[model samples]
Target chain A: MPGNRWALRYCGNMLSLTIKEVSLALREGKISPLELCRKCLKRIKKTQHLNAYITVTEELALKQAEEAESRLLQGVYQGILDGIPFAVKDNFCTENIRTTCASRMLKDFLPPYNATVVQKLLDQGAVLVGKTNMDEFAMGSGSTDGVFGPVRNPWSYAAPYREQSGGAEDDSEWVITGGSSGGSGAAVTSLTSFLALGSDTGGSTRNPGALCGAVALKPTYGLLSRHGLIPLVNSMDVPGIVTRSTSDAAIVLEVLQGRDLKDSTTVQSPTSHAGFSEDFDVRNLCVGIPKEYHAPGLSQETLAQWSRLADLLEGAGARVREVSLPHTQHSIVCYHVLCCAEVASNMARFDGLEYGHRSTEDSSTDAMYAASRHEGFNAVVRGRILSGNFFLLQQNYERYFLKAQQVRRLIAEDFEHAFSAGVDVLLTPTTLSDAASYSHFIQADNRTRSTQEDVFTQPANLAGLPAVSVPTALSSRGLPIGLQLIGPAFQDGMLLSVAHWIEQRVGFPSISNYEVPNK
Target chain B: MLGIHQIYGRRRVQLNIILPLLCRYYYASRTDNMLSTNVKTLRKTRNTPSRPVTVARLYSSNKHNSKVPKVPTWEPLGEDRIPSLPQVSSDLVDKLERLALVDFRTKEGLVCLERAIRFADHLNMVDTTGVEPMDSVLEHGQLFLRGDTVTEGDCAEKLLPLSNTTVEEYFVAPPGNIPLPRREERASMLKHSEF
Candidate 1:
C-alpha cells in the first residue's frame, strides 16, 4: 500500500514539470534525476518528427544525468538548473563536438572549446540535450537555407499539408520557422529543451521567437560574450536566449551575462539589477510609436493588432505617443553595405586552411583556396561574400562603406533624438508581416533583388540597442504576430521588465495551444 | 744759374765725391760677384756631402756639364729587408699548459675556447671594415687601394706626379668578352641551353 502511494506521488510530480518545478521536486526527494532524464528523452523521441534538433546526445545526456542524480542524493545540488536539459544553436562551439552552423563549410568541423554561454550553462549543471540547426552561417531570414534542410514551422505541424499548391514544386507548402534562430525557437516550442541559445544579428532571434510562439530576448550589444559564436557581423552579433517564457529567458540571461577576456568587445559593467524575475510596475511608462513603421506594406491585421496593443497599454495606465525616426528609410542600404563589408572580412579567414572541409586537390595555392571556398559555401553565403568584397574594394570603399557608416550614424542619432524626447520604450512589429511560405520567401522580389526586408530590424542592430519580440496577437490563419520593444543601450533589464508587463497584459497563447500530431 | 768759378769749384769738389762713389760702386760689384760665386759653390756641394769639396771643384771647372749624378731625397725598401717577430711568447705557452690542466679538471677552459671560436665566427660573418681587396674587381673603373695611383688632370701634357699610390687599375673587357651579353643574344643562349 505504501509503495503504491509513493509511486502515485512520483508519477504526479513528474507530470507537467518546468525547470523550477523540477528543482523543487528534486529537493523534496519526490523524483530521481534518472527518472527526470528518462521522461525528457521520452518526450524528445516522441516529438522527433518536429525536427527540432540536428543531433541528440542521448548517451551523454544520460551519463550526465546519472552524475547529477548522485550529487543530488549527496545533498550537493548545483543550482536551479542542476538537472535541466537545454539546447544551443549549432553556430555555438561545443567542445569536441560537431558545430555545423547549418552550413556545408563547417559540416565536419569540431571545436576544441565551448562557447562562453554554453560553458556557463554547463557549469551550472544544465544538461545539453543537443545542438539545434540554424540558417546557413545564420545569414537568412528563413531557416530554409540550411545545408541539412529547411526547419518546418512547429505551429504548422498540425496544419493540413497541401499537395500541389504552388509555383515551385520543391518549395510548395511548408511554413517557414523564421530564421536564423528558427531551430532554437522550434526546439523550445516542441519541448526538446527547456532553453536554447541563439545569435541575433538583425532580428534573427526575435523573428523566430515571434513565429514559433516563444519569448526571445536580444540583449544589449556586448552584454554577453561572442567568443565562440560563428560571427555574421562582429559589431552587431549578440548571443541571445530563446525559451518558453520570459522568466526562463531571464534566468538564462542571468547565467550567461558577464565580461569574458576572450571577447574584448563585451564591456565590463557593474552588476545588473538583482532578481530581474521580480514583478515590475509599468503604470508611468511611455511607449513610442514611430509613424514611419506604419508604412504602406503593414498588413491590416498587424495594424489592428498594434492599435489593440496601444489600447491595452493605455488601459493599463501607460502613456503612448507617436514619434518619428527620420532616417529609417536609409536603414536597409546601410545595413547591407556594413554587414557585407564585415562578412567579407570575417569570411576571409575561412580559406580552407586550418579547419573546416578541405578541397581534394593539392593544386596551386590560389586554386586550392578558390576550390575549397566554392565547394564549401552555399549560394547565399557566396553571394553575400561577393557583395561584401565588392563594397570593400579600394575603388568603392569610400562610396559604399563610408556612406554606410554615415547612414548608420544617422539612424543611431534618430533613435537618440526619439529617446531624448522622454520616451521610455519604442514598439513596432517584429517583421512587416507574419511567416511566409518557403516559395513565397524565395520568389519574393526583395529576396531576389536585394536584402531589403531588413529595413525595420537593421536600424536597431546598427544602433547596438536592446530589443525584445513578444507576441501581441495571432494572424487569422493562426500565425503569431510579435511586437518588439526597443530600449536604450544597457537598459536591457528595463526593456525586459516592460516586456514582461506587456506579456502579462496581452496574454499571448503558449505552445500548449498547438497540438503535436501523433505519428 | 751760379757763377762759373763757383760752379767749377763745386764741380771739382763733386769730382772728388764722384771719384769716391765710383770706388764704392766697384767694391759693391766685386762683393756681389763674390756672393754669387759662394752661392754656386754651396749649391754644387748640397747633394754629395761626402764629395762636396771635389764636386765644387768640378762644378767650377765645367759649369755646363750635364752628366753629373743626382741624389734622391727618399728611397724605397725591398721586401727582403722587412723584420720578422716570433708568433708566441714562452709565458703564453706556459699559461696555455696550465689552462689545459684546468680544462681537464672542470671544462672551463674548453668553454672559453668555444666562446673564442664563436667570437671568431661572429667576426667572420660581420662586414669588412678595411677597403675591400677585390674592390678593383667589382668596380669597372680606375681602382685605388690606400691611395697608390693617379689619373688625368685638368691641364694636358702636365704629368703631375702623385704624392701617393692613388690610381688603381682600370680593366676593360674586350668587346665580345663582356660578362653580360646583349639581350637578344642572351635570350637565344638561354633558350638553347634548356632541353
Candidate 2:
C-alpha cells in the first residue's frame, strides 16, 4: 500500500519535495506519512554505499511512521515535523540506539536516555531515519576521522569533462565534506535524510554545509537546550540545523529552539521571539561587509562571486556597508585555546571506569586512564586535548587560557559595537577558499590552509552569535562557495530570515554532482 | 578561619625550626673556645676554609665531643601523635544550629582552601601558576561534600547536649561483634566501594 502511495506521489521518479512539502502533502491526503517514510528509506538503501550513516533504523522508523499515520488519520497532528523523517549526528544520544561519536570508544555503548533535541523531534512525530557518521568526538574539519570511513564528497561523482585540447579528463577529486558535521551535510546532499541536527561549537555546522552544498544554520548559543548534546565547549556549543533549503532549516530550528531547565545556559532573551516563517522585509536592512574578512589569499573567483552577491543585494535596495571588526584576527587562536581547554575538561569524564570502552589490561588507575583515553580518542582529538592541557598547565594557563577568554570578550564586544552602529547582519565568505580535496587536506600545508579558511567563520563562533552558510555561487571548477550571514546573539530568526531573503535573491546550487544521474 | 590559623601556625613552626639553628651556631662559636678551635682545625684539615660549615654537620656531632653540647633535633609530630577526632568549634556548632533553625538556611560556607588545592592537584586539575583553578575545584568540592556529615543522625538531636564529650566518644558508636562476610560473599562488596 505504501509502495503504491509513493509511486503515485513520486510520479516519474522525480519527487524532490522538502520535509515541509511532504508534510503538507500528507495533510492534504495527497500522500501518507508511511509513504513518505518508505520513500526516504528506499533512497537511503539506494545510497547505502555512500557511507553516510553509521546505523539505519528501518524497523523502528516504519513502526513510528505507522503510529504517525494513525495520528494523521485521526486529525491529531503533533506539529510541523510530525511524521517527517530526519537524521541526527551520531554524537547525539538515542535511547537503545548505538550513539557513537564515530569512534571506537562508543562503538558498543547505548545511551539509556535520548538527547533533548532528539526527544523534542520524536515528540513532534519526526521519524528518525538513522544516525549519520561524523568525525570522532566532532573534532576534525573533515570526516576522515570517522570509524566507519571518510565520507566522500558527493560532488566528486560528476562525470569527466572533455578537455579543450583533446581527450576526456577525469574531474572526480575527493572534496572534503567539512566536518565534524560532515555526515549531516552528506545525508542531506545525498537525500538520505530530509533534514539533520548537528552541534556546532566552532564551524561544525556551517563548514560542512558549505562543503556539501547544503543549507546550514548555527543558532545563537543559549537559544537551544544543550542538555543531552555532549559538549565540546559548554559556553560556545549550540545545536544547529542542516537541510536542503533555508525554509526547511527555519522550520527545524523553530521546532528545536526554546528554554530548557536542564540547560542553565539557555536564557529567555528577546531574540527568542517566535514565528520565524513570517514575511521578512530586507529592502531597508543594512548588511555589513567586514574589511578584515576580505583579506588577501581569498581566491579570485570567490571574491568575484562575493562582488556579484553584493551587487544583487544592492539591487534589491539593501544597503551594504564596509564595517571593521578589529579583533577578528585573534579569534582563531582564542577559539582554539578556549575550545580545546574545555574539551580537555569535559572529556575527562570518560575514564573507562564509569562508561565507554575499557582496557582489559590490569593496570594502575593512572595507566588505565591513559590507556582508555589513548584507545578511545583519535589523533585529532588527542592533539587538541594535549594542546589544551598544555595551555592549562601551570606555566601557561594565564598566558593562553585567560588571555583567550579576554580576546573572546573583545570579539563579542566587536560584534556588539558593529550592531550598535546600525548593521543588521554581517556578510563574509564561509571559507577563504573552495572545498579542498581529501588528499590535499592530509598534507602538512593543509593544516595552515584549513586554519586560514576558518578565519572568516571562527569570529561568529567566538562571539556566540547566530550564523548561517547559504551557498551563493559555484567556483569556476563547479564547486560550491558559501556566503555567511551573521546576526546578534539570540537573533536566530532574524538571521534565518535574512538568509531566506538571500536564498530568494541569489539561488544556490542545491543538487551537487552525485545527485544528478549520468545523462 | 580556624583552619587558616592552623596552617599559618605550621608555617611559623617551620620558620622557628630554621631560625634557632643559626642563633645556636653563632652563640656556640662566640662562647665556646674549644669548639671554635675544633671547627678551625677541621676547616684547616679539609683545605676549604672559605666554605661555611653546613647545618648537616651540627646534627651529626657525637656526644663524645664534650665542648659541643648535644643539641636535640626537633622532629614534627607524626600522625599517630596528633588527635584524629573532629574538632568542631563551639561558635561554628552554635552557628550551624541557629542556621538550621531557618527553613531555607543555606549550607555551610567553611571551605579549607589547602584541602581544596590538594584535591585539585590530586585530580591533575591545576592551572599554570601551580595553583588549583579555584572556580572548578570549588564547584566539584561543593557537589561532592555539601551537606555531608562526619556522623549519622541529626547533629542537634544527638550531639547538642553532649558538647563536652570528645568527638570520638560522642559520634562513633561501639562496633558490634557481628561475623564478617566471607571473601566469596565480600568479593561483590568491592563494587559498592565508590561511596
Candidate 3:
C-alpha cells in the first residue's frame, strides 16, 4: 500500500495511467467505474485552486457509473470507451446541463440538446465528468478573461492563489493556462478527466495542450460534426480533443467523428483509415519543417526541442526537410477579419429578445438589443462583434473583408504548396514559448496576444488541415513546450499516427511524471 | 466548400455499410493497439490533392493595385506604434455604436476598439493580387445538404422559457414602431449597463 502523502496527492503519480491502461484495468475487473468517478470528483475538489471545471456532474456521473458497472457485470459493455470518464469544454452543449461558455450571458443557460461530440461520447458509454471553463464564448487566447477566474496551470500548484491566505491577485505570480481550451488542457494534465473536448477556432485547444503537457488534437474541418458547439467562428471552428496520449486522442476522434445531418459542413464520405502500425518504419515518413513558423517571439527552448525532435525523427530514418509557407505572415491578420466577420454574424443571435440574458431596461426593442448585448457579452466579445461589423460595412467590405478572404486563399495555398511538394506532415512549434505568467501576459491586450501566440497553429486552421501538439520537452522554467504536427485535410488517422510516434520517442514526462510535491 | 475531388469522394454511402466498416476499423485500431498493430508495412503512396481553387485574394485588375497597402501602425507582440488610433474619430465611434450596438463610450471600450483596428490593419501589408478570394474552406462552397425536412419539432416547451421575458408562447420584445435608441437614450442605457 502507498503512504498517506502518496495517496493524498493521488495525481502526478498514482493516477498517471492513460485511457488505454485504465480501460484494461476496467476490463480485468481491477478498477471500479464508480470508484474512479468518485476519485476524480475528489481530485477536482483537491485542485479547486486550478479552477479547471465549471460544473461537476456528480449525480449524472454516478448514475452513469452504476449503469457502466451493471453493463460490465452483464458482459455487455460498449467498446473501448465504455466506462471512460471525460470532460467537455463549457462551450459544448450538454442537454439539461448549464453549458455556460464561462460568460455571464449564458451562466444560467441550459442547453436543450447535447453537442454532437458530447452525445457521441455518452452514447459510447463514456462518463461525462463536467464542463471545463474557457474564455467567454471562446474569444481570448489566455483563458484569463472568462467570467470564472483564470485557470491556473497545475505546474503553478505551489504558486499562491487569490483565495488562499498567502496568495495575491498579482497576475505576474500566476501562470496562465493558454486559452480558450485552457481548462480542458489543465483537466487532462491534472488527471481530473482522461480526455476533454475543446473547440479550436485558432489554436485554442493546441495552445493550452502545449502549456499543460497534454496531447491536443484539432481534427480537420468537417471531420467531426459541430451541431451544438456554440459557434465562435463558423468557418474555422472544429471540435478539438485533448488527451493524455496521441492514441487516446485517436480513439476518441474515431468515436466522435462522422457525418451528422444536423451539421451541414460535415464531410459526407467518411473514409476508414488503414490502421496505424507501431512497427511502421520511420523511413516511410516524410516530415517538413515549416520555415515560416520560426517567428520573432519563438523562445530558444521551444526552437531547440523543435530541432531536437526533428533530429530524433531523422535519426529514426525519416526524411526531414525545411519547407516554406510564405503567406504565413498574413494568416493571423486574415484570421482576424474572417474570424471576426463570423463572430459578428454568430453573436447577432444573442439578442435579449430571444433566449439568454434579457435586459430589464427595455424602453424600446432597440434599447433592449443594445442594453442586453452590453450586459450580456464581456468587453472582448463585444469588441470583436463591433469590429467584425465594421469590417462588414459597405465601405470597408472590399478594403478589409473582401481583401482578407483573398489573403486567406494565399494562406491556404501556402500550406497546400508545402504539402504538395512531397511532404507528409509539417512540424512546427505550437506556441512561441511555454505558458506565460498572468502579469506578463496581460500586458498585451487579447488581440495582440492571439496574433503572436497563434502564428504557428493558425496556418493549419486556415488551411483546414489537421494538427496535433505533442509535449516534446520542458522549458528552462520547467514548463511544458509542445511542437505541432500539421497533416493534410482528411488524413486524420495519418496525423495521429505521426503524433503517436513522436509521443513515444520524446517520452516527455506526462503530467503525472512531474514531481511537484502536493500542497 | 469541398473541392471537386472531395465532393466526388463524398457520395451517399449507406450508413449501414459505413457503420460496420467503421466498427472493424475501430476494433482494429483500439486505443491500446492503435500504435502497435503489426501489419505488413507497405510503402504508402501519397494521396494526391486533385481539385484546385486558387486561395481567396482580390483581382489583379484593380487600379489601386499600383499603390500597395502598408501597415501604418501595428507590429505583433506589443510593440504598438500608437494605440490611440487618431484615424478613428469620436464621431466614427458614435456611428459604429449605433450600427453594432456595442458600447465604446467607456475609455476601456475606446482603447479596445483602437487595439483591434490597429491589429487588423496589418492585413494591408499583404499584396493579394491575382488571388481568388476563398469564399469558404470547402471547395466551391460544398455543403452537404440533406433532403429538406423537419429535424426537430414541438420544442416551444423547451425553448420558450429560456428567456424569462416571454409572454405565453411569444417572447416579449419592445414595440417595433420606435426607432433605435437615440444618443441620449444610449447614454442612459450605458449608465444602466454601468460600463
Candidate 4:
C-alpha cells in the first residue's frame, strides 16, 4: 500500500498526512520543512507529464523552506502555513514570477505586485513551489484550452508501453482535469503541494475538485480580496483553496482571509468574526437538498452518491429534507449573460497596447487593436468577449443584460429564503458526472458544453454563497464524485465544518500512491 | 475552409427561418472576404430597391458581385436592417470596433455570438418583474472608502521595465491621429507605467 510505502520513506506514513498533521510533526521536531520541500519537489519533477505547473519556483521554495527549517530550530514558527509547500493559480499576480493565466497573450507577463493572498501566504512563511496552470484567462471549464496544453488527471491510469504499437498503449488518451483550477487540483491530489490556491468563477474550483478528488472551497464573495486576482467576473469570482482535506482548506483560508486595503470590494470587517472549527457538532444542523438540482442529465452514479451523503448526514443526526429553489432553472442562463457582460467589460483592458501580447500585424492603431485581440485570446475567450459586448448593446441591454441581472436577484433571493427558513446548508452534486475522457468531452462545442456543466455550480455563484466540494465516493471508473455543500454568505466556517464531517465519514481515497524518501 | 462554410450554411438556414430580414442581410453579404468588404457589399445590396429579399436573390447577388467591389463607407448597420439577430449584429461588434477599439472578426465569430444569444434566450423565458437588478451580492454594506493618504508612493522605475516598449520615463505607444490621445494607445502605455 502507498501508506506502508510512505512509512518506509519517512518517520511515518507521510503520503496520507494532512496539512495540520504535517504542522504538528514540524512543531514536534519530527520532520524539517526542507525535507518536506525536497520530497514535494521530487514528486513534482517525477509527475511532469501531469503539466500541473505553469512555472515551478524551485529556488524560491528552497529558500523559503531553508528559512522555515531554521525558524523551526529556533522555536519561532510562523504559524500553520509556515514552510508548507503550496501553489497558486497562474491568474494570481505573483511579484516576480511569470503569471501567464495559461494564455499566450500574457506568456511573458510578470506582475510588478503580488496578489493580496500571495503576500498573505508569504507573510506566514508558506513555501510557494510553483504557479499552477489554468484555463486561459479563466474563461473555460475544460483544462484543454490552456496555452501549455491540458493537465492530465493524476488518477488516470498510464498504460504500460507496448512494443507492438511502438508507443505506450492508450497513454495518449487522457482523462479530463476540470478547468480553471485543474492544475491546482491535480497538484494537491498528487501530493506535489500540500495546499494550492484556485479561483472559482462558476465551477472552476469545484469542477476540478470533483475530477481530481480534492477538497475545494469558493468562499463567500468579498470575504477574500480580489486586488491581484485577474478578474473574470469580479462579482462572482473568489480565491478558492484546494487541499487534500477540508481542514487543510480551512487552515489556508484562515491564513488568507482578512480585510485588505488594496481590494475595496473586500468586506470591511476581518474574517476573524466567522471562526472555523473542524470539530463542530453536526447533530442539530439542517441540510436542504434543492429539488431543482435533480434535473435531467445527472449521472446515475452522482445521484446515488448524493442520496448516500444525505443518508449519512441524516444518520449522523442532521435533518435532511428536500427544499425548493424555484429560480435554479434560470441560473445557468443568468450566469452566462452576466458573466459575458462583465467579461466583455473586464477584457476591454487587454487591447494590444499594454502588458500582454501585442500583435505584430502593424498597420494602424484600429487594425492593431483588432488583430491583437483576435490573436491574443483563444476562440473561447474571444467568443465570450464578443457575446458579452453584444448583450450590453443599447437595444439588447434591456432584453438580455438587465433581464439577466433581475433573474440574478431572484437566484440570490432563493438562497436567502432557504437559509432564512432554517436550512444551515444546501447539499448538491458538484458536477454532472465523473471526469469526462478527453475524446468524449471534445464532441460538442465548448461554450454549450461548459454552460451545461455549470448548471449545479452556477447558482451558488449567482447568489454569492460560499460553497465547498468534498469528494464522497469513487465512480465505477475509479474517478471521484464530489458533493457540494453551499451555505449562506459569511457562514463559510459552518459550511466547511459540515464538509469536514462528511469527509471524515466518507474516508475518500487519495491518489498519492507514490512516496519519495526524505533526503 | 476548415468547415466554416458549413457553419455559415447552417446559420443562414436558421436565420432564414427565425429572422427573414437577417437572412436577406446575411445572404446579401455572403463572401469569403474580410468583414469590411462584406459590410460594403451588404450596404450596396441593401440599398438597391430592385432586388426582392429572397434566397434566390441572395445567391444571384453573390454570383453577380463575385468581382472586387468599390470601397464603401463603413456605416454601422442599423438595428432594423439586421433585425433580431442578437447573435450577429446586436451593435456589439460595432461597439467593439468603434468604442472598445477591437476590430478582428473571424469566420466563426458570428456562430460563437449566436450561441451566447441562445443561452440568453433561456434566461429571457423566466419572469423577474419587481425584482431589482443586482450589481453585487452584498445587501447592507456601504462602499468602504479609503482615506486619501499616500500609501506606497511612485515606483515607476520598478514598474516600467515590465513592459519592453518603455521610453525614458514612460512606456512608448502608437500615436493618435486625433489631437487628443487615443484611449487605446494611452491605456496600452499606462498599464505598466506605475507612476
Which structure among the candidates has the greatest TM-score?
3
TM-score per model over all chains:
0.68, 0.70, 0.84, 0.81
Give DockQ: model 4: 0.13
Worst 10 residues of 2 chain A by lDDT: A159-168
When only the first chain is scored, the TM-scores of the models are 0.92, 0.93, 0.94, 0.94
lDDT of each: 0.62, 0.63, 0.76, 0.74
Please give the lDDT score at residue A127 for candidate 3. Answer: 93
Q: Stretches of candidate 3 above 4 Å error?
A: A1-14, A158-172, A268-275, A515-519, B1-86, B140-142, B193-195
Candidate 1 docking DockQ = 0.00
- Listed in order, the DockQ scores are 0.00, 0.01, 0.19, 0.13
Question: For residues A153-218, what per-residue lDDT tens digits would candidate 4 score against the true structure?
Answer: 876642110111123344655677898799998888878898889999999999898888899999
Give the runs in model 2 whose Cα sits over 4 Å from its true position.
A1-15, A159-172, A271-278, A445-450, A512-519, B1-195
Prediction RMSDs, each to the true structure: 48.0, 28.1, 14.9, 18.1
Q: Pick the candidate with the highest lDDT.
A: 3
Per-prediction tally of clashes = 9, 2, 18, 1
Instruction: Please report, as a residue range, the 10-residue window in candidate 2 chain B with the lowest summed lDDT.
Output: B35-44
What is the model-wide C-alpha lDDT for candidate 4?
A: 0.74
Model 1's lDDT to the true fold? 0.62
Instruction: Report the C-alpha lDDT of model 1 over A1-519, residue by residue, as the tens digit.
Output: 323322424665352455667667776667776667777688778877556677787888898888877777777878778888888999999886789988777887777778998999888887888888777898887887788887777666532222112112233355677888888987877666778898898778887887777788898777799989988998789997887666666777778887776776775434664345447766778888876676545665565456556655665677788788876755665666677678777877675555675555333443344445656776667656655655665755655566666666667878989999989889877776767776677774223312434545767888888888887655644466787889887777778788777776555655453345323
In order, the B-chain TM-scores come to: 0.15, 0.16, 0.51, 0.42
